[model samples]
Target: MSTAHDRERAWLLVTRREVVSRITDKSFLIGTVLMVAMIVGFIGFTAWQEERTDEATLGATPEAVAMAQAVADAAPQVDDKLEVRLVELDDDAAARAALEADEVDAWLHPVDGDWQLTSESSEQDSLTAATRVVVRQQVLADNAARVGSTVEELEAGSTVGTEFLRGDAERAAVAEAVGFVFVFLFYFAALVFGMQLASSVIEEKQSRIVEIIAAAIPLRHLLAGKVLGNTALALIQLLVYLAVGLVGLTFTPYKSYVPALSGPAAWFLAFFLAGFVALACLWAVAGSLASRTEDLQATSTPLTMLMLVMFFGGLSLDGRGQVIASFVPPVSAVVMPKRILAGGVDWWEPLAALGLLAAFALATVWVGERLYRRALLQTGGRVSLRQAWSAAE
Candidate 1:
């Protein structure tokens, strides 16, 4: 008689069948399309935001051209470049006419050696604020010049110098957004796929299919095939996302960011494998503990909770917290990527994390195989952990 250990063909066939079944599933197809759409939409939205910046139109009299020049010299806070389009007019009437006709965002006219600005709304925009600052500075200089003194003299030579510390924080907002996307995608996908492995195991057990399959194939092969097949699908989905994302990034000006992000991206894949397998084994264990979908909640709740903690906790880590996560299994997959995106990660962290996670994954597989062999044949009701533990392997 051919036993599961006598030959690997039966289990290999089982793995192939599972991979084909999942890849051809209608829900999987729809989910893939939706995921692609969301990622594309996100990339499009980012491109739009990068292109959109505040613009200001300034209407000024021919004599008040200095006001426009001052506005031009002051950079708007939005893009660090002031877009002050000057519409020259002969008098205040023409300027007001332009302003009322929406020809300019705001207008400036000279009155008895003083300048007055007119706008449609009380709320100030970046351009408007910049224009105000320039006008004030110019007026101060002019007042000092009238008295044969300088604006500097009036300030008593006290100038406040403010410096911006970009230091790994310059791209903070962007990094945080991208890292959130990366972490959450991995976090949610891992949980969903892990549960899928569990549900498949339970489904096969509940249908009594495992009895026939185990009779023909070793229980270990069966367990390995199920985990391998689902993991392959999960990886295909993740790679698709990464490829689409890279393509999108290439189209945008942010393509330069790819090289820096690639390391973390690679780590994400490595950790994802280790993390998924570690969790996937538990999922298999969870499935073997239950005979039906209804019975899965109690068995799988701990698995779900562990994933949730990793997801939320990974989001909260900083420098030291992230380093600590790098040594920890599963969550390290997420934490390390975030640090990479944030920049300033050490060189050895990824290697260390990957090693630790791989070790844990191997241990999990051992335990999960034992659990599967013990409980996969038990039926009719929920199989408690105690019962499965005491059952012959």
Candidate 2:
């Protein structure tokens, strides 16, 4: 009798071989480097947007130099990113020339005891806000000096109070963006690795590799090993990506903003494992159904379309629908993690979803075994699902 331990060792050897093969591939190495670069570039872009420190050069004529200086001094109070560097312009002609040259974002002119700012757009938000505050303070100071009063006393005008009403549904926009990455990453990973899984199976079967391997181990063990191996690779790929993202986050202004995403990240990985396992089996089934590499697309279209629905459906659905989707099998494996970030997910919700997903994955494995067993070596042409299902064992 084949003991459980012997079967474990046998399947483990198969899994180890697949993992080694995938990681050692030249394409995987190259792809990892490219993925790293892409991750860095995206992180840098997001960090730049959050900082908004793009310098806006200011050409200040002699008359407005003092006001510009005042604004520069008050820049810290307005916005840390708001930088004002004064460029001395000799005359109006020079100022216009500076503007034309695009050497300055705006020409600051003092006309008739008021500041005039000439820019491409009327709305120069940082400049406008800083100038207004400085001007208001200047006016108050002048009045205080004339009346023998303090600027603070004169500036104590009517107050406007503000408050925010937050609800349970109100999640940070940044959090949702992070969650989208998690879900969408899984969506993409499933498609890519799923196809890879199918291709791997097809290649082996075509080369008669599966027959040689199956002569020693049970076909089911070989199947389990293949699934386990590829699934490990898929997970490692996601973890590498997730690690890169988290590390990248630390360098970004979003670092502080998105730290709370750890909870969602954990949930994402949990669902990712289950979802990919289910998808990976179908991928293997697709491979089993196809006779040649050319037949892969045609045979796998149904399963490919199924995952595509999860991707597109995730984009269109929200709230109750998304919540409902979290519990559904393959969809649950992708969208539910995002729902955890996007809404008030109950503690029991993930447990229930995971349980259901586990059951579905097991069912998929059994079906995948059936498909793989009946059709894997019958490689004269593409095998129909009906024929594979009803064909004699």
Best by lDDT, which number?
A: 2
Q: What is residue 128's positional error in candidate 1, in angstroms?
A: 4.0
lDDT of each: 0.80, 0.81
Clashing pairs for predicted structure model 2, backbone only: none
State the weakest 10-residue window (summed lDDT) of model 1: 162-171
Global Cα RMSD, each model: 4.0, 4.5
Using TM-score, give the best candidate's number: 1
- Please provide, for model 1 over 1-393, each residue's C-alpha lDDT reduced to its tens digit, 9 standing for 90 to 100: 885465577667767887999899999999999999999998999887777766678877888887786776565543364466777788878877887788877777767876777787654467667766787888899889999999878998588875634344436665787788778888878778887888888888888988988777788888888888887888889989988988898877678776766767787888888888888889899999998898889998988888888888788877677778757877787887777777666688778878988999999898788887998898968888788878986
**TM-score for predicted model 1 compared with the true structure:** 0.82
